[model samples]
Target: MNKHLLADRVKALTPSSTLAITAKAKELKAQGVDVIGLGAGEPDFNTPDHIIEAAYESMKAGETKYTPAAGTADLKKAVSQKFEKDQHIAYSPDEIFVGSGAKHVLYCLFQAILNEADEVIIPTPYWVSYPEQVKLAGGTPVYVEGKESNHYKITADQLRAAATEKTKAIIINSPSNPTGMIYSKEELSSLAEVCVENNILMVSDEIYEKLTYGEEKHISIASISEEFKKQTIIVNGVSKSHSMTGWRIGYAAGEKAIIKAMTNLASHSTSNPTTTAQFGALAAYTGTQQPVEEMRAAFEGRLNQVFDSLNAIQGFRCLKPQGAFYLFPNVKEAAVSCGFTTVDEFAADLLEKANVAVIPGSGFGSDDNIRLSYATDLKSFKEAIKRIAAYVNEHSSASD
Candidate 1:
């Protein structure tokens, strides 16, 4: 008999549906299908010229040697200053760890902290990777569902009910992935109180910190109190803010001990983020705010256009998002009325018939929704929505 080899954890893991959809969209586009993809998560903007120049200069200066496992001192200090300036949360250089991206830093933290059977409280409609990463780290993911009535924000009572003696941490993604719902200061304080009382570590993903719309300021849970800061890990980066996703530089600020452990894990796994990327990220932190604000304004304008267009369609319910570039509209009513059994079917049909690609809500732990990224050019955005609206209207009278 042939020998079979595979780790049980690896065998049990599910493929990322979001990435799968993105890949399929790309495949269709490559085949000259005129695919309008609303599934991409990253910004469509290019990295700023100044930041790109910094990376070019670094290469010329031969700053190619490997740096510290965590990051170079300059980058770490830049990250420290960023927290102080933006979030009003102070952090020492020792409390910072730089990784390839916020995603990598989060994975390393989980690998260091989670033990077998440890429970992690995650709010639903979360980023697709949260639960899978927890499972890969040998932790159990306990989901707390957020409803539309509350603007998709989970309540303190919900967090309390999901907690147990075995619970180790809670993942909080304000300006959340699928819904783009941000927790207000009051809401964050209430949830922080629960975590403080229960001794739960809070992993706050603030990657989209600068992309908020209107008066909805992004509040860091760590900024609420020193006690909360001690238990909270603030994960952020320049990917969304500076449109530097391809640069692959992200960092986390937290208690010195936890940061140290994450750095040690990095030492063994990936030694450090690319030297050039770190230099570019440092420039991103120190550069002027004009580019960042420009991108934010564009996203805000596009967001309004998409939100209004989606709300006009029959059987579609949408809430105006306060942050992030994506609009997640609930299409359950449309699914039921148009003979589609699930959001997945709705998305697939739209792609086939309307030639528009979107991510199904089930990928983001939502069953009745679909996420549409308006990160493309305005012309493409308008055309895609027009096609989508027409298709839904034409199919609206069908019975499931």
Candidate 2:
């Protein structure tokens, strides 16, 4: 083997199918085909003007030097205050570490905490990066299924069955990515107790906490108790909540020792997050929250307008998601009934024939479904649903 070759780690990693599908849609559009892409998980709204102004001011003031690897004092204070006000938990600045994005924060976290051979329990269908990050940190990823009937949430009993002596951490994503299901306070309490009893660290990903519909509320698992708090690391940022995805600021708050270790690791990897972006995040936490509420309302309205029509598509059964902007509908029967061998093939065929792009559930640890993000305009989203229904109606008849 050549010593100049790619590292084994990079070779073993799987490229994100979500990004692949989105790019394919873009490719077709570049060639002049009409395509509706439902694979992106980003908001269509722009970042608020106040946040943008703050970042511009920071740059104009020549505050462009590298900040402390952990974070600037102002941004850290903002994160601390946000946590206390929203989650009923308080963290000193020393307990927090901000990174380029929530995704980067999570990577640094696994690197700081995991020993080789340690296991991280992840609930499925999870975000595409969870297991991959664990692998990159040399930790084993143990998956426990979150069944469809429970709206794709895991039970405390299932969590207990998956824990072991080598279990080092558990990741909880509330207002989850693909399924958009949120665990209630009662559900969170039981899961928190299991983690506490097992001395397992909990990594709560609350990136989508701001977008929920009706009675479903997002709860921070770390807020369950002081004991739970001591063992939990709450990870979040302004990407989803403030439409600041491009601004690239996310953070982790937890026990001082772990946060310090993550901060040290971050110093060697990506030096502190972008300075201007940190100021933007500071404004995101302190400025008027009306923009956040308005965006949430818009997502809720989109969900209401598209849910029934999406579920009514032939051979598809979709649960009304309680939060976030995604809908994961079981399409295994639909796929087979439509003469496609799998959801992946069906998704490809939809893109090729109806010019619709969707991320198949096989990428999210479930082959029976496909995930759709309603973060685009309601007019386009409704049209996508119509195209999906037309595709299913036209193809599923072959099964009869």
Q: All models: lDDT?
A: 0.90, 0.93
Clashing pairs in 2: none
Please identify model 1 stretches exceeding 4 Å from their true place: 1-3, 398-400
Mind giving the per-residue lDDT tens digits that candidate 1 earns over 363-394? 88889999988889888989998998888878
Tens digits of per-residue lDDT, candidate 2, 183-254, equal 998999999999989999999999999998999799898887888899899999999999999988999999
TM-scores for all candidates: the values are 0.98, 0.98
Candidate No. with top lDDT: 2
